[model samples]
Target chain A: MPVEGYAGDGHFRQTYNDIHILCQETAKRIKTEFNPDLMIAIGGGGFIPARIIRTFLKVSDSPESKPRNIPIQAIGLSLYEALPDTSEEVVGKEVIRTQWLDFSTLGDKNTKYGGLLGKRILVVDEVDDSRATLSYALQELQIDVEKQLKELKVSEEERSRIREATKFGIFVVHNKLKPKAGEISKDVAYFSGTDIEDLWVDYPWEMPDILKHDELKRQDDEMAVKAK
Target chain B: MPVEGYAGDGHFRQTYNDIHILCQETAKRIKTEFNPDLMIAIGGGGFIPARIIRTFLKVSDSPESKPRNIPIQAIGLSLYEALPDTSEEVVGKEVIRTQWLDFSTLGDKNTKYGGLLGKRILVVDEVDDSRATLSYALQELQIDVEKQLKELKVSEEERSRIREATKFGIFVVHNKLKPKAGEISKDVAYFSGTDIEDLWVDYPWEMPDILKHDELKRQDDEMAVKAK
Candidate 1:
């Protein structure tokens, strides 16, 4: 499934330590499964992923011990013409390169193959844009949808829908800024942007669901009444 | 002279930004008279001096450009045995090395030269340690006392006292656990540490002495009567 949402909220909004922990987990996963020649990260905010990868490299003790040769590279991809005025210094210091690719450049020729063809690409965004302008571009590049779906853990139903909708392509629509009808493909999955405030609120509740169980609730209520 | 105290409130302690402003102002006065090759920063928090130096580098546009140098070397002298556990990552990333030197290391003839000897040191601390063990160590290093005094903007009377005291040789009392007692020496000059609550209380009254001559007090009396 295409994960989309604000990273600062809910399950995504993570602390530096938390990001480090996730990196450790990812490093373990990579060690177990595929050791692709190169790991390509595509996103604007490159610090988090790059730091994670760096930390992983620091901690991981692969028998090969060839970290210097098999490097994890990150390339920033953005839709806007101008670079976003964010923490560029921090990002520049961390990432290899910042690439700007305009989706409009893909036109009818197909976008998938234009940049990310056979490369194992990791697509990151606040939300999944159904326009598929970026994803379609990748698909045209001869990227196998089945492989990507399996890797990303997308449900079989979602994979079937994506394969079926490959013909017409996709379009972009904004809930707040409504687009014309048929502008976007309905078959593609959409993820709501994660907001920081919402993440702050949801993080505590995301703890084991047992905290919300009837027994816990009754005990909490009894304690409160007794204290009162 | 060593300066200390919290800013705004005890809860919201003063930071490097606050100290940098004052350091810059002091730098302006002595910039022409004594061009410093190195700045020896003594106790505050490690971050504050690091920031002050960083800020200085930002504004400094001299031919030497002291700030941009890779090993922007400086010692962070403190009475504390260990440097406070802060995100030292800031120093490493910025490529600025703020080396920590314990005050206890001073006065041992066998010890290598550590404290500011001939360098135009900027001492930042809450209070002066009259016992002078640390100061004597620096003096033994053949540091130009006259030059240091001038850089510190010491008054003539203070200069004489420091010169005479140094002749006899001074020593700093070892009091890591408890606060030490001692007024600033003649060689030292004071910088006011930020106290926001005090500023809030004193600012209005600090207006022109001429304005305080008559009308303001009458207005205060009338206001007091109205409250009654």
Candidate 2:
């Protein structure tokens, strides 16, 4: 995530506070709405709120902060995971592991369970950087990844491969970093590219399971095509 | 801001299409990088990309079809103004004279030239019924005002005031809707709340002088604060 520097202005503080409030609201909503079995938070700087919410859950007595049955897992895709550690007491129960996997380190073949395989994983990283890495990683994991890669402006060869792999259920985070002209694709889950503070509520999490199942089917169809 | 139901197993097209690709990219960096800009966008939703960026300038191209400039006039206590008629031809600018006003509307007293003031704006129809109305009207306006309102969670009192107002500036169109949270405070040009999507980039033509001055002043003071 990019940080804007504004001399002595309280912009940073205001921004942080805004993000914190959003985090609290999101936590509250999750508690009220679809109480998922797991919250797989992807991306790096975006992980701050997840960490804060985790801390709040551990300490706050608010009704909204009551103990949760589901685990909130923070996954960092880069070379390192920078979020604070989970409370030892909550480990394995409330909060799960904060694992950092270097996809670059993983060779073509799968190494272990931790290695990307059929596991339903969410890739969260800056769109540009993540696009390249996600495409490559999913391909190596033998999972189909789907994305236009037009924003990344990659070559046709790369685009074709990504399309082929995406047939295996890989998805991308959609939203804009700045305002521009064009229609937003209705195919994928998108959050506002400009707004990072409302990640909890604004980002679409209500994706239907049928879509995932359909994506899997697409992958199967593609594989069958290749076989033919 | 039309919400189209996709039947392709949930996987549709890219949300940011091609025209607003830069906006999406810039927003990502804004949230991640420390780049400087007077205004910023923060939030997530289907319509965020165009709403946030279009508030800055108009782009004329495919997908975005009618692109026009929407300049920023001022940022003050929960209020922002996109100068009237600032948007260009491609985007077909239409002023949505809303029937709602809130505490943010009070700040409209600052609009000296022909701008929003003391307008009988419509507060959202009662929350329950209002959702449908907002959805309908917002769709007509081509902006998801309801989604933005939901994300904003404006207080009833504020909503009543905005609704009772006599005049106001409204922007509407119909492509993608970008709903956001936070407001520019009424007193200073300070932004409160979380997830701001900087809209200054879109309206390159009508950058508010006051905002520039305030920003510079804020920067100087911040320097002093940091030095202390």
Candidate 3:
């Protein structure tokens, strides 16, 4: 529960309030800069922040009417095996699932409610560790988006144009400063709430004894203050 | 965003800390009473608590091994016209999705991970206002579970046995104590974190101004104290 191997009060901890603020602050930039149409949250860890940030991402053209919530799709990702940095992803099929994802609910092109055709998609998670999971998500999403384009009976030029317009962005509460196992290209609009040295930071959700976790976190705060 | 027409400063606000504790406490009972295999979260509102509760519901077979996090399926649900108390629901297809849920990922009966065949299922949401959404979700899920049973070419007795074993439970953070628009049968094990009068309650996730919301919540606390 408290991150497998390191299962005690020895790890760095964060309060629920801090994480909520991080998501809120980052979402301000995402609304104006990225302007995503939909979001795909990597399950479990990403679920909390993805829902939190959506409150800020809501769009209301006119104040009189209700603000529209950005629809979010939560998906699962598991690493097959460590691959070479240059090699293409195996594209894990067990989780991505061709039965759905841009085929049924998300793929219905005509419906104003559905369709990922040329819409901007934001991929969210709690942290960017090795980035193996993030890389897998981005790769599979790119394939799915292209498949949606291919199904459409349109000219090659138009298909390419729509493909280009269908942008992808990455957002995570914490982006670790370390060599990643997977690589992300510069084309995607990447946004991170904050960057920190690679450290074991326990999310509030993972802590079974939250009060004690907060007490330890407070001690850390005191140490930093004393050092200063 | 703040529960439609009942917006602005006129709302009962809850802090993030309070909600987290509510979920953790409710989860303790859910763990003993109705141990769920997989969760189906009524999306947007349900997403937050569903994720939070999963953290506590996790099972660690051994201390050395990591605790298994319950997989969650976030789904969309919208009402199709207000039906009479006894009238049947016009099952909304734009959202229910036949392609997924107990069909693809959840339906693969052979895989230990997938099947909804005879597993305990938990349907989660933040608030149960009219019970329309929860009723809709339970009906669709019941239909889907039966469909899974029908697909298998088994004897009638065996099918009935499997159906009986499949249990369904409901969990919500807040339950408004009033006559609901939709009806829920007595069989389903229901759990709500707290019950309040039929008033507009503002969840932290929906707030645009969280600080102000918390401050108001603090005032409510003070008022409650003074009244006592």
The segments of candidate 3 whose C-alpha lies over 4 angstroms from its true place after superposition are A1-10, A62-65, A79-102, A107-114, B1-10, B60-66, B79-102, B107-114
Per-prediction share of native contacts kept: 0.00, 0.00, 0.33
The deviation in Å at residue A123 for candidate 2 is 6.2
The local distance difference test score of each candidate is 0.31, 0.28, 0.71
Q: Which ten residues in a row have the lowest lDDT in candidate 2 chain B?
A: B72-81
State residue A100's C-alpha deviation in candidate 3, in Å: 6.4
The regions of model 2 sitting more than 4 angstroms off are A1-15, A28-34, A55-66, A79-176, A179-228, B1-228
> Can you tell me the CAPRI class of model 1?
incorrect
Give the runs in model 1 whose Cα sits over 4 Å from its true position: A1-228, B1-12, B15-27, B30-35, B57-119, B124-180, B183-185, B188-228
What would the C-alpha RMSD of candidate 1 be, to one decimal place?
22.8
* Interface RMSD per candidate (angstroms): 22.7, 22.8, 6.6
Model 1 TM-score on a 0 to 1 scale: 0.26
Evaluate candidate 2 and give its CAPRI docking class based on DockQ.
incorrect
Shift of residue A23 alpha carbon in model 3, Å: 1.1
**Candidate 1 residue B77 C-alpha distance from true site, Å:** 4.8
> Positional deviation of B31 in candidate 3, in angstroms?
1.2
* TM-score of every candidate relative to the true structure: 0.26, 0.22, 0.84
List the pairs of residues colliding in candidate 3. Answer: B102-B107
- For model 1 chain A, give the 10-residue run with minimal summed lDDT: A168-177
